[model samples]
Target: MLGTASPTRAWLLVEEPGPWGAGGVPESRLGPEVTESLRRTASALSARLLLVRRPGQAREDDGVRTLFRVTCTRGRERVLVRTCAAADVAAAAADDDGWTERPGNLLLVCTHGRKDWCCALRGRPVAQALAALAPDDVWECSHLGGDRFAASVLTLPTGWTYGRVDATDAVDLVAATAAGRVLPALARGRCSEAMVAQAADVHARLALGVDDVAALRPVAARRDGEDEALWHVDLADAPASAAPGGVLRVTVRRTAGSEAALLTCGAAQEQHPPAWDLVALVARQLPAG
Candidate 1:
């Protein structure tokens, strides 16, 4: 079984020119001290740390020129900073209000073998395939959690996370994403929203046949019971004739499996994790008075 998809709030990318080995991104490239500092900073900021590099030939240089990108969905911000060492990332992570509002997108394929074998075994091929399709936009990033869902992908700027992806699905995923559509079957959820909102977004997308990435936005979310939540979402930029002020209410219930299993390979067995189930969906169109 695959790992459950969850939402994330932000992403932190660090550029490292590499000839990445089977072990994944070489921490040796970043040096021991800088590596430690980067890990600490990323954890403190609750950011997913990724290693990125421009596709193609490796440049001959003794020192690495790193570029750091911080992506936040709260204000729709993407900030980029250039530095000579990985240790410098701390300062950028420390800044709370320095992100620039812009549209920046990247395809991050997790291949962190040290963290989990499935990631390297299942993720590398997908990354290579995607790179062939969009060289400038694809990258082999570090762990993005959910090792059980190896070959997990995070589409940036929009922060849509997908799991259990394979090489065969790379082309269609890229095409759909480029056309501003979300693939519900493979989609985990957007990192920008909460868990219930993520589930609601998926349900709404499938119900309305709405594909645009930014078409639906969460208006409100609230708990209705100990294990159930309701979400109100608005359909943005819809045709007036189709939906006069389109809105949807989605109900999601939290459920648990009867068995315990390892969340990821090499991890101890644990109680079943909570899973969300879509119970009902209601669409409303306000009268244009």
Candidate 2:
């Protein structure tokens, strides 16, 4: 699941403390017209609409809802919150007022069972584990893609999505994020970046032994003109005492999996998802200033 993270730079998480259908928001109790309007708003903002709730069976509608808009625009990451009724939540997407800026990060664990059985089976325990550590920061979110990679966790403001996470390591993962470091082993990719950039970023992080989430940023990515399988990506490194102006270049090849299989529980047929392989990695020094 290296480069399989969903590609979305912005996210609109609506607090819907109730059951979610296989289709998530559309199937939730948000009503048909409201759901469509929310979908349009999300599409207009290039954001994903995720239904989120506090962990467990405390599903009583209190006539109040919290809406969060998180933007993972690389260096300009930020989270905005708005409190409004469920009926008026969609209007908050484009509205410029009444939004409070929030700091730190948000942990979203997929527990939308209707979407896929694996999610409910594996995601809930992980969510419980994480919420135990950071009650205010953790949420049971709707489908996060890659159902086969259940127990998927996404950290907001940075858009770092993790896959195949276990309940035992949930605290470690959240602690790592709080400390501004990344657990590379379970990372799927950052939702804000393209697939090639995601693959390259992970490869660069591993190759350089850098775990800090802010240590490297994707500077450029391009596909080979002659070969669709080849991609070239460059990452800009943050200033450091050892290497002030450093850049890392990564080359990756995209190929199909050796065998097709069921990627999600809801799928009726099997297919092969694209796989990214690291070809080469090189670190270069910038010319003297």
lDDT of 1 by residue, 17-100 (tens): 654443333464667666666667777878766676654445665454555555657446465555554445556555554554
Off by over 4 Å in 2: 238-244, 268-270, 285-289
Candidate 1 TM-score over all chains jointly = 0.77
Q: lDDT of candidate 1? A: 0.68
Best by lDDT: 2
Q: State the C-alpha lDDT per candidate.
A: 0.68, 0.86
Residue 62 CA error for candidate 1 (Å)? 5.4
RMSD versus native structure for model 2: 2.2
Q: 61 in model 2: Cα distance from truth in Å?
A: 2.8
Poorly placed runs, candidate 1 (over 4 Å): 1-6, 17-32, 39-48, 53-62, 74-104, 225-243, 258-261, 268-271, 285-289
- TM-scores for all candidates? 0.77, 0.92
lDDT of 2 by residue, 111-188 (tens): 999888899899999999998899899999988889988989999989999999999998789899899888888889
